[model samples]
Target: MVRAGARFMATGPAQSFLRRYGWRIDRALIKATKGHLSMSMVMPEVLLTHTGAKSGQQRSTPLTYFTDGGRVIVVASNYGGVRHPAWYHNVKANPRVTLTSRGYRGTFLGEEVLGDERDRLFELATQFMPNYAGYQKTTQGRRIPVVAFTEVR
Candidate 1:
């Protein structure tokens, strides 16, 4: 994670450039570190594995996450893009998922929070990542979804 005060967030255009390509770099670091470091100082991240909604193929994405009791919370921000991310659709199609983070692996089920609950989670997420507030502002009516990955017994 990029430290809060770090100059990780550059200017608008720079940030946009990073948003487009930084994931590949982060993914390599994550692989090398075995999830020990996600390369973002802003917040911790988890590598989420799920089946593709359309292709029915397995896919993985590294995403920043927040802890909530026994569940892990994640936002489908997609860097404030207009459309919901592909992973979001995959999670919706098949809630079952695997999360690898910090030398731990777990089986979990993804569920989207809605309405009041989503609002609460959004607020909580903004606390961890102030950038989320900006992401929300650009979204207008298209809400960035907040999802919880709960462990399965």
Candidate 2:
């Protein structure tokens, strides 16, 4: 098992600084660390690969995903920032995606949940990490989005 606290200790400073500067330093750290921090702290079960909506380029992001029956749930809080994250926009443009988890990698279909479904999933996710509640409070009016990715084929 990876020590979650240790991973946070490694990236906490950078994350905090970036949060203040209105930049995504976490992405840089994740890329530089090659998923080490995510593996250690977040226990990320899925790495989402989304094609750029306009450019059609491939973009991959490691996210903390949780399995709910047959679907995979991912949060789009972006630490409750004013703007949506790049990955969120990528998924919005292209609903098809790929994911890797538990040494398994495969293609999947993605979609944003709606209404009660989204609320329920958000509640479930908050149970896993209560900090999400604090994250929600950081935003002014935009409600954080929760996206669901389901296996295809």
Query: Which candidate ranks first by lDDT, i.e. highest?
Result: 1
lDDT of 1: 0.83
> How many collisions per candidate?
6, 0
TM-score of each: 0.89, 0.77
For candidate 1, write residues 56-97 as lDDT tens digits. 999888888988877899999887778888999999999999
Ten contiguous residues with the weakest lDDT in model 1: 1-10
Q: In candidate 2, residue 130 scores what lDDT?
A: 63
- Candidate 1 similarity to native, TM-score: 0.89
Q: Which candidate is the best by TM-score?
A: 1
Runs in model 2 lying further than 4 Å from the true structure: 1-14, 17-37
Model 2 clashing residue pairs (backbone): none
